[model samples]
Target: METAVADRKDTLDVEDLAELCRALGHPARVRILEFLKKMDKCICGTIVDSLPLAQSTVSQHLKQLKSAGLVKGEIEGPRTCYCLDRERLDQFKQYVANL
Candidate 1:
């Protein structure tokens, strides 16, 4: 029973890490993150204008980034503001270093 519990916990951790990695699997998502890093904060429309991709494409990438916990989004009335989750990114960096 103890071993089963340990295995389950390990599985969950692996899944979580894998999900984050998968979220970053696209080049567009990486570019979006880079763009966000340069700004204090941004909205979806601004990101769409900066990138060559269409608005819908940028939105998809933003969705993935937000889902990964690498980006934080706040609604400002009609618009959703976005910024990098620096702490989470730092944690991911440390995880890679340890690996």
Candidate 2:
């Protein structure tokens, strides 16, 4: 229904929505984002302890989020610190707001 607004600009196709939704479709992913948002930034170990998911599973979800340009993680020592990609997130916010 809200897609009518999107139609006026660049039409958002299923692939685009799928990528966005896929990155956000899981409860674990949502939790991860929420935690990252609250903490501002956290390491892999931090996110692992914050949720019940295994380290590998959390890493997979993080990868998906990164691929969607919703999150970013940088390697530092043996751990990777993760945070929201604010610029990309703002783009997403603008897209939704316009829609």
Using lDDT as the measure, the top candidate is 1
lDDT of 1 by residue, 1-99 (tens): 999998997787678778878888898888888888899599989989988998888888898999899999999999989999998788677666756
Tell me the tens digit of each residue's lDDT in model 2 across 1-99: 568777754545445656777788899988888888888889989899988888899899999999998899999999899998878767666666755
Clashing pairs in 1: none
Tell me each candidate's TM-score.
Answer: 0.82, 0.80
Overall lDDT per candidate, in order of appearance? 0.85, 0.82
User: Model 1: residues >4 Å from true position, as ranges?
Assistant: 1-10
- Worst 10-residue lDDT window, candidate 2: 8-17
Residue 72's C-alpha lDDT in candidate 1? 91
Stretches of candidate 2 off by over 4 Å are 1-9, 12-15
Query: Which has the greatest TM-score?
Result: 1
